[model samples]
Target: MILRFSQLIVGLILFGAGCAVMVDAGIGLDPWTVLAEGISKNTGIGIGWVVSITGFLVLLLWIPLRQKPGVGTVANILVVGAAMQFTLPLVSTPDHWIARVAMFIAGTALVGVASGIYIGARLGPGPRDGLMTGIHQRWGWPIWAGRLGVEATVLVTGWLLGGTVGLGTVLFAVLIGPMVHVSLPVFDGRARRRRHTTPAAAVGGLSAPGT
Candidate 1:
């Protein structure tokens, strides 16, 4: 059930692409996006760089967890930040409420796609995702609890640094798991399906596949 490097790359790309679309929509972004917004404000190296930097830091959290930092780990380190920078300008929304809202919905869906792809790969773990897993193990908390704690910590830090936080952020917390859960199965290839047919699969309803 170990992930190959190709699967890892696909997952990272999905994760990264989702982030780009979500932000581009500008309705709101996921909790991690909120964190990135904060970093971008303080660093002023652009939002993209902040995302990359944060991803790198989060990935580091995995090493201490006894998780093997594989090609997927390396791919995550490079892809998200790079993908953010590369894709942001290419895809954007118009300056209207309707367009923005539609974009936001699309963005949320993209996040699901990204989550499904990356989590499906069952590669090591994205830095952000790794943070949640690390906290869960250390505190013996549920995935939701760990995720909320990790996200709240990041969101507050991001807010202190002036990252975007609003209804969109709230929406991400409330809805992202279902979206990811539903999408992964739809997008998964036959190989992935065979790999996923068994477990109950409900860590906040979005447990990473093959994990």
Candidate 2:
């Protein structure tokens, strides 16, 4: 329990810091971050604050979807943006385009790893993730369709609202799914345990709910 909680907190903090890195890169951002950035640009709010506020607002939408929040979900709302806020002021954009691209890639990779770690803790889905799943569960829409529709809306809206749209955004879109796919299994604690446990163990007396 202690280990899972620690992993969850650390992963969320890293995820926020990774976002700060990408923002400081100033090339382009993921769809959600682009939305946050666009709002921040227009409202003069810090991007991190926008992220937290947006998260809370998104969580409210869960009521209609009948989604239940978990410890990790609540922590995600509280911790990620604060960590980003703390980290952003410390990072500055690079002078060269190459360096900026590299920073964005690094940040994206960090976020991928962080996603695995926090999600592997098996506490709960983040609000945005839950929203996607809920859409599928309630309406029987495919997950990909729900994700694509929502993300495309956010991406286009954010672009219209003055968020950066460039190669980095394209790169993120192309790479993130694969990145998460690779990272998820590595950090998935339950899966890890399952892999290590023998078939004999499963049939012999150790069977339980998650097994």
Candidate 3:
């Protein structure tokens, strides 16, 4: 449990730092970050504050979906934005395009790795992830379809609101899914262990309560 908690904290911090790095790269942002940036632009609030607020708002949505948040979920709301705020000032954009591209790539990779680390803890999904999975569970939609629908809506809305949508955004869209796919198995041993140890849940499979 201690190790899982430690992994969750480290993953959230790294995730935030990765976001800061991508923002500093000045290329583009993930769909959700783009929405946060757009909201920040419109409201004259800091992006980190917008992110934290957006998370809380998303959590509210979970109430109706009957999704339960664990310690990781609440920690995700607080720690990620705070870490981003702390890291942004410490990181700077490079003048060279090559360096900026490198930063963007590194940031995207870090996000994937961090996601695997945190999700592997199996405490709970992050707010955005819960939204996607909740939609899947409630509507019988495929997880991919749910994710796509949510991301497309956010991307279009963010773009309309004057968020950056550039090569980096395209790169993230193309790469992040595959990155997480590869990373998850490497890090999700804990979840597999839990499933194996809890044979009844495994036997019932996807239809099981608390599955």
Best by lDDT: 2
Worst 10 residues of 3 by lDDT: 202-211
Q: Score each candidate by Cα lDDT.
A: 0.71, 0.91, 0.87
**How far in Å is the alpha carbon of 2 misplaced in model 1?**
12
Cα distance off (Å), candidate 2, residue 81: 0.8
Model 2 regions more than 4 Å off? 197-201, 204-211
Ranking by TM-score: 2, 3, 1
Arranged by lDDT with the best first, the candidates are 2, 3, 1
Model 1 misses residue 12 by how many Å? Answer: 2.2
Write model 1 residue lDDT over 1-211, tens digit each, in one string: 4444565576667667767777877766666777787777676786777877777777777767754565556678788778777778889677987887677777777767777777666566666666777767866789888877777787787777777777677777777879877877654576565566445654345445563
Q: After superposition, how far is residue 125 of candidate 1 from its true place, in Å?
A: 1.5
The prediction achieving the highest TM-score against the true structure is: 2
Write candidate 3's Cα lDDT for 1-211 as tens digits: 9988998899899889889888889898999999888888898987887888999999998987889999999999998988888888999999999999999999999988988888877777899999998898888899999999999999889888877778889989888889888777677886556545556655766334332
In model 1, the clashing pairs are: 14-114
Query: Please, what are the lDDT tens digits per residue for candidate 2 over residues 155-194?
Result: 9998898988787898889887888888887889778777
Q: Which residue runs does candidate 1 get wrong by more than 4 Å?
A: 1-4, 63-65, 187-211
Q: Per model, state how many residue pairs clash.
A: 1, 0, 0
- CA lDDT, candidate 1, residue 2: 48
The candidate with the higher TM-score, 2 or 3, is 2
